[model samples]
Target: MSGQGWERRHAAEYGTTAWSRAVVSCGALVAHHAGYDRRPGAVSEAAAGFRQEWMPVAELLALAACRAGQAQDRPVDDVELPVLLGWADGAHTHLLHTGPLDGHLGPAHWLRLAEDETCRSRARDVVTTESTLAIVESRELTGGRTSTPARALRLGARAAAAQARGVGFPAWADDCAWAADQVERLHLAMQAGAWRPTSAHRAYAREVHRTLVAEPDHPPCPAGAVGPSWIQRVVRIPHVRATVLALAAQPAYAVAAPASDPLGAAVDAVVHVGMEPVSVLAAGLERAWAAQLPDRPVAEWELAHIPGPVREQIRAVEALALRLTVVLLDLWHPHE
Candidate 1:
């Protein structure tokens, strides 16, 4: 499509309406934060990116959160959705509740709100206290300890309204919806210890190696020791390994991975199709980096490559990726 056509498509697909613009706008903000254009082409690119990189992780979180919320009898709200979506945005922008948001809206506030006579009465009528607490806690934790139940509840109300009007739904909303179903799978996996850190690390390493070997041009290391070295490094740094595994296990990571793999994928899917000279050039550069550390972990390779501008871009992407992962994990595994 023409640039104008793409722009119109994006606006229509993600633009605000009376009831739901906030949620859609939040989704757009996520794309924008993740280095997407918030235009039609960019949305398509993000969709592609989401499919590759983030789908699995997002599916995990969505299924887990849904079950948790349902078990607790709490209704999910726009605030929580946006926070999760933002993490999936590949930008990891901090989602704040800038509200005409009544009084103080923090975790404590959410707890109090849940206990409010009116809220309790309402929740009792529609949901169980356990469910209400679960929802409130999920919102609070997802908000990074800054959001209140009142704000979260209000946001939920807004999302409901938006859904009613059919405004700002993501083109990839189906993927997100599927993600919700996947949460139950994740819970089951967790119960079975299928998501253990050791197992996750091994899987991630294998995937990276597989991707590297499959694309011979993108060899892992100059000497082909990149994979082993990456494993060693990750194993050594318990904290980093834990973080990496945790992130790898998120639904957004899997969702965004497909969309952002090779950077150009997102660009092509969202901005324009075919091989643009700029993207081809970027891909070449990425290949060169991969070749440099044929067996190194991507995180290390990213740091080792000293192109100042590229490093900065990587930093930005990492920051967003990290934030999104944190929010998702927090929601499902709050004690952790």
Candidate 2:
């Protein structure tokens, strides 16, 4: 709980290990904006259990958090298991790999500077140059079409890294036109049925759907899934409905209705991060897809359109996402 040590350790390991690598990898994947790492096993077992009928969405989220944060350490403490930090750290990729620092990096590609303390200064130069190289490669891949926020973040992160390395900061461009462009695109997409999740998001939703259908009648946890130190949490239908209403009540998002894609809420969450939060929309869309695993058509999925019980079971994912951002920047964020 001592943030002092946590900060030192996080800075010590930031982008210097498997966890940081995963962050950059995920970030690059997301910064590309439209594609996912759809190769088989792209969704690791670590990312699995998203819709396990027995596990609460909260726990499934916690487990994945444990895995991502655990990259700094891979397992969550008993008391701190619920919050996830992958979102914030994952965003580091935008800073590390976009613009002039881009690269075809992923979790598997391991790159580290010399570890000798005597070589610390030289090591930093290596990191800044490497970060720059990654940016260069990413720009090459994107054909010089990097967005505004993406460019700013990559430069900012690299400069931060250079500062950490005891080097001078590099000057960067001030063109940030892309954030507005993205927000506009989102609105246009919504008009064209973009708020809804595509078919790809269905698999995760199906699991949550089954869990809702079987709950209240059957036991909370299925056979063998239950264990000590576990508390059963059956989400209440009315409470969930109220929370959704509250979100819609004072939202900065355009889609306030339940049937509206969680994309709107996700973009709202990004505004809080102060960077290009729209990138997080990809993850939100996947979650929204899960929440909408209704037994009927989405057009009829207005809050009232959903069954009370299932609606309770299928909750908004932005709450978890925003919470994860906090966990990343606050709890697990090494900067403390």
Candidate 3:
């Protein structure tokens, strides 16, 4: 690799443990075979995520690492071939926008894989679909920023997660984009409005729900949207401060979000928007777009949609969704 400062500092640490060494070796092998030699710390950077993997995936990593070492190969072995192709496909998309982007893999590597008759048939089926999906997703995460370390890291995560389970992002992604944007803007406004000596917290709370409340200047006509009286009953409404975090949690009280639960879509919205850790929210978002698990409970659960620890936070989000729903109802109801 490029002997970047980060690699120099952490490379020795890779030698400190079998697991760490495996990650570095594997990451480096992939980085090397894929032409990332000029890029400093590529292997070590990819290595950081190896901690949470299981043995089967680890075995694949070992194979990938070794394969990269020899012929300095393109792609990886057949154990998790689908995931590897996906990993490369997803990783390459996001890496393109990050800094020192010069030394990374690209379409050429995927093309070589297609040439292999064994993987060829399958590759032909999904390559175009996944690659196009990755491009759109990576762009959203990075946005216009040339240096989003978090978004950049997502490239590897999507790849690894794919390798582990042969899946990409969740299906309800685009549906949640507006809510995520709203929450993010609210988060910033809360931070900036903190200077009010006495009621900064209350002010923050009001600002958090101001749009829903239809406050002066932010008003959007209450008569058109659902009435907010029921939801505003909770006195201690929390800010968008994410106390509980999950990559994505299926909070549906009933399977497929029971018909009576008007806010099931809302719950799905906030959950998929990812209530905590912005990086997770931004990562795999594209995969979610490409995937569509209409009513599959196992698929939903395996997608890692719920962060079980933050039960209260999730309930809070659900309540807020109720409140927000009223706002939308009022906006659209004109006669309400």
Candidate 4:
């Protein structure tokens, strides 16, 4: 499918209401894959297979991420496959897409794709052997980390919790939150030297299975309605601010966001606009669009409906929206 098609498909499946959750899940996946595991064999056979075929499938995800205006614009690469899969896993928890290949695709499939003999051989030759320094240098420059199984579990749990909360079914939310808390405890235990890394993995897997078994059979929402109350509570403007503050407290976001970059400025501008009276805010939003995106219009940004320049501006607007969301959350609920 075309990029725009993929965006609409994803939005239709996931809903714009939960965009923040999707972005957070994606970021967490990147962190888990990069920080926790580096060995090629660590990836499951299915995941490896998906990775091998990622060149084609990834276009959909890339388009979706771009349209959503995620934090970074990292293109798909060997290092990114695992991360993207992680994000998809998280997204699945809340907005499960039941398409032609529903049961057939899962983490294992993607893992196998990555580790397929042909793909692995190609990766070794292209990345590990031909341009080893380039790969290493790129990782260094990007500050990428090796994937850790424990971190993956933790991230999975967190993503699940986020989705569950957004879906607003109390039973699912509680279950997901409990699962995440369990993973977090394991993480803490590992940090305190109370458990071995392998042990933590086993524990996490057990907890995940238990949570799945415990989950309510009923859906979180009506076929086409917003999720439970808790989820809505967590996603509202104030709640979003709280979540952002919590995220900022993490070492990653604190370190990654530059103080005075274009991203920061864009965020500031958005927050400033949002803070105005609702009427004023609406007018100012239009004015800002006219001033910054005059030559290129918003209509053009649509996948099929808009012009190329307008589409480009739409992409920029999405980016600005992400920055603004981050900034507003940070300012309204500043973390230590």
Task: Give a tens-digit lDDT track for model 4, residues 97-160.
Answer: 2222112344454454333445333322322221232233234423555322222122223333
At residue 240, candidate 3 shows an lDDT of: 31
Query: How do all models score by TM-score?
Result: 0.19, 0.19, 0.25, 0.19
The ten-residue window of minimal lDDT in model 2 covers 167-176
The count of residue-pair clashes in candidate 1 stands at 54
**TM-score attained by model 4:** 0.19
Cα lDDT of model 4 overall? 0.31
Which regions in candidate 4 have their CA more than 4 angstroms from the true location?
1-3, 8-27, 33-228, 237-336
In model 3, which range of ten residues has the least summed lDDT?
229-238
State the lDDT of candidate 3 residue by residue for 86-146, as single tens digits: 3323333232122321123334543444333433333323333433433444445346343
Per-residue lDDT tens digits for candidate 1, residues 1-336, read 433443343245334221133333233222322334333444564678745543333222232222222323332222344333332221331121111212223434333432334422322322222224335543443454543333333223322222222224333333223333343443354457665434333344344323222312322344444453322222222223234445455764453242433221221122122112123224323433434434544533332222222223223323332333333353333464
Q: Candidate 1 — worst ten consecutive residues by lDDT sum?
A: 93-102
Residue 44, candidate 2: how far off, in angstroms? 11
Candidate 3 off by > 4 Å = 1-54, 62-157, 160-204, 210-273, 280-336
